[model samples]
Target: MADREDKNAENVAGKFYVDSQCIDCDLCRETAPKNFTRADDEGYSFVYKQPESDEEREQCIEAMEGCPVEAIGNDGED
Candidate 1:
């Protein structure tokens, strides 16, 4: 279980992270469609890519803030 968790974490690194508390609101996708997409099973937002440009980064930040459940965050401290 620990190894699986670690692998999952690694796969999602450098991208947007949705904590277990996510409510599947889809605000992140609405805010940053290019970088976030809805998961088919849960309808929760997941990162499509780690933003590289200033505009994309700003969009990600907005998505993080707009999340009703506060589910979205960068992989590490900002």
Candidate 2:
């Protein structure tokens, strides 16, 4: 599970975030390109935008579920 305390600083203030456990995988990026992005220097993924629509929300959820390291978290502000 992703630790909110350890969430990446690059992540915007939102429900979806990526923690330190992230392994630089492209899964979230591929699954939710609009909401998630790569921190090239850090080699980790972080949530850049909160979902603005049902489709975007679903995509973020899919990315969270597909994360192999369980680095994605959604228990945040709505």
- Candidate 1 lDDT by residue in tens digits, 1-78: 012222223224664566655676777777777777766776555676778789988998898877776677665533
What are the runs in model 2 whose C-alpha is more than 4 Å off?
Answer: none
TM-score of 2: 0.96
Model 2, C-alpha of 49: deviation from truth (Å): 0.5
Which one wins on TM-score? 2
lDDT of each: 0.65, 0.93
TM-scores of the models, in the given order? 0.73, 0.96
Reference-based lDDT, residue 20, model 2:
95
